[model samples]
Target: MYEDHARIPPPPDGGYNLNALKPGNIRHYDYWPEPPGPQTFGNTQVIFSDHEKHMVARIRQADAVFGCMAWLTNYAILDALAGLEAVQIVVQKEDFLRPDGPGWRKTKLLRAYKALDKNLMRFNIPWDVGSCDQCGDPSIEGVRCMGVHNSGRKSASPRMHHKFLVFCHLADGYPEPYAVWTGSFNATWNGTRCRENSMYIESEPIASAYAQEYGTVAALSEPLDWQYAWVAPEWRIGS
Candidate 1:
C-alpha cells in the first residue's frame, strides 16, 4: 500500500544552497517559456509515442479492465470526470454554493450540480445530509454553508473549501472513484478549465482504501443531534 506521504514528491530544490561555495552549482539554467513535450519523461514518452507500440498493444489486449481512484485538491478532476459515465461523489455542501451573478462566474459548479442532479434522477439514487451538528456546521443553506464550513480550515477563500465526495461507475465495466480533501471544485466550465494536477491510481488496493474512506464518511454523515431547519430543497420539491 502506498502511504499518503509517499504519494507526494519532495521539493524540487533543496532549501537554498546557503553556501555559495559550490562552483558547479553557480551555472545558470535557461528557463523554457513553454512546457516540454511528451519526451519530457521516459514513461510518458513511451506511452504517448509509437515507439512502445507493441507494449501498448499488449496492455490494450488484456482482458482485465481499468479502474481508478483519484484524489483532487483542486478542480483538475472535473475535466477528467466529464468523459466518464457514472460517479458517486462525497463533498462538503459548500463546494456547490456559488454566488449568483452574471458572466462566467459559477459556471463549473452549476455544471457539476446539473450533472449530479441528472444522475440522481436517472439512477433513482437517494441523497441525504447529516444534521448540522454532526456536520460541524451551524447551518446548511443559511449563514453557515456546509460546503464552506467544512473546507474553511486551511483555505484562504472559504468559497474554495467546499467539502464533497464523489463516486462514479462507468458503463464500460471499469469503475472510477474520486475523493477530494476539500469540497471547493465546482463542475462548471470555468471550474475545471485550468492548470491543476489530480492524482489517479489504477491499483485495486488504492481504490479499496478510497472506497473504505467513503463508507466511513457515509456512516458518520447522519445528523442525529441537530434539528432540521427545513427539508432540503431538492427533497422537498421532489426534483
Candidate 2:
C-alpha cells in the first residue's frame, strides 16, 4: 500500500520538469521513523494559535470528535460525554475486572460500575460489555469465570486469562471513543506508575470497524478445552 503517486505533466519551461518524474505509486515512500527535527517540550503551554483555535472550534461545533488509545486518560473523555443527551459505551470486560482477586479492588470496581451506570442512565446513555474468547474456563460455557481448569490435571495454572477490550463511546453526533494500552499497566494505583502513552483521534470509519470487530468477538466466545486456574469461591465477592 506504500506505492508512489502518479507523476504530473511536464512544465512548458525548457528546464527539466522534475514534476514529470514524480513516482506513480504514492505508497512507495518510506515512512519508518518519522522525520526528526527540533522537538517541543513543556506542560500547560498554548500550543494552538488563533487560526488553529478557530479551525478546531469550527470542527468541534460541527458534529463529532473521535478518539482512540486514550488509556489512563479515558476518564477525561468519559467526563466530556457525560453532559451529552445520550452516549453509547463499549468496553472490555477486563477494564472492569480486578486484577488482585475479589478484594477491595474488586469492590471498588463494582461501586464504580454502579456509579457509572447511574450517571449514564441520567443522561439516557447506555454502556455495553464486550468479552474475548480467552476469558473464563474452556471446559464449560460461562464456567471459566468460576476459576476451574477444563483438564483434570491437578497441576493446572490457577489464574484464568481474561481478555482485555478497548472502550468506545459516541455522544451527540460524534463517533465513539476508543483506548488501548500495553505492558504492566492495570486498573490499579500501582500500575499507573509505569510509563505509558495514549492517543485520541476523531474518525467514524475507524470507530465503526472496531465496534464491529468487538461485536464479532463477543459473539464467538464459547466453551473450549483451555485450562484455567481456580481460586477460592469465597474470594469472588467483596474483601
- Put down candidate 1 lDDT per residue, 1-239, tens digits, no spaces: 31232222334753321111122222253222332223423212211222122222332332221111122223334333333333344343333343444545366545543442212221122222221122232222101211223343564433223223333343354334322221222333233432322222234445445555543433223121122222222212112
lDDT of 1: 0.30
Q: Give, for candidate 2, the lowest lDDT window spanning 10 residues.
A: 119-128
lDDT of 1 at 111: 58
Which candidate tops TM-score? 1
lDDT of 2 by residue, 1-239 (tens): 63545344444863433312434544555433322322234311121212222222323332222211112123333343333332223222232243444577556544443332222221111111222232333111111122343345556444333222233444562235343211222222322333322222234454455545433432322122222233223111111
Clashes of 2: 25
List TM-score per model, in order.
0.36, 0.32
Query: With candidate 1 superimposed using the best TM-score fit, by how many Å does residue 1's alpha carbon deviate from the native?
Result: 44
Give the Å error, residue 188, model 2. Answer: 3.6
Per-model C-alpha lDDT, please? 0.30, 0.30
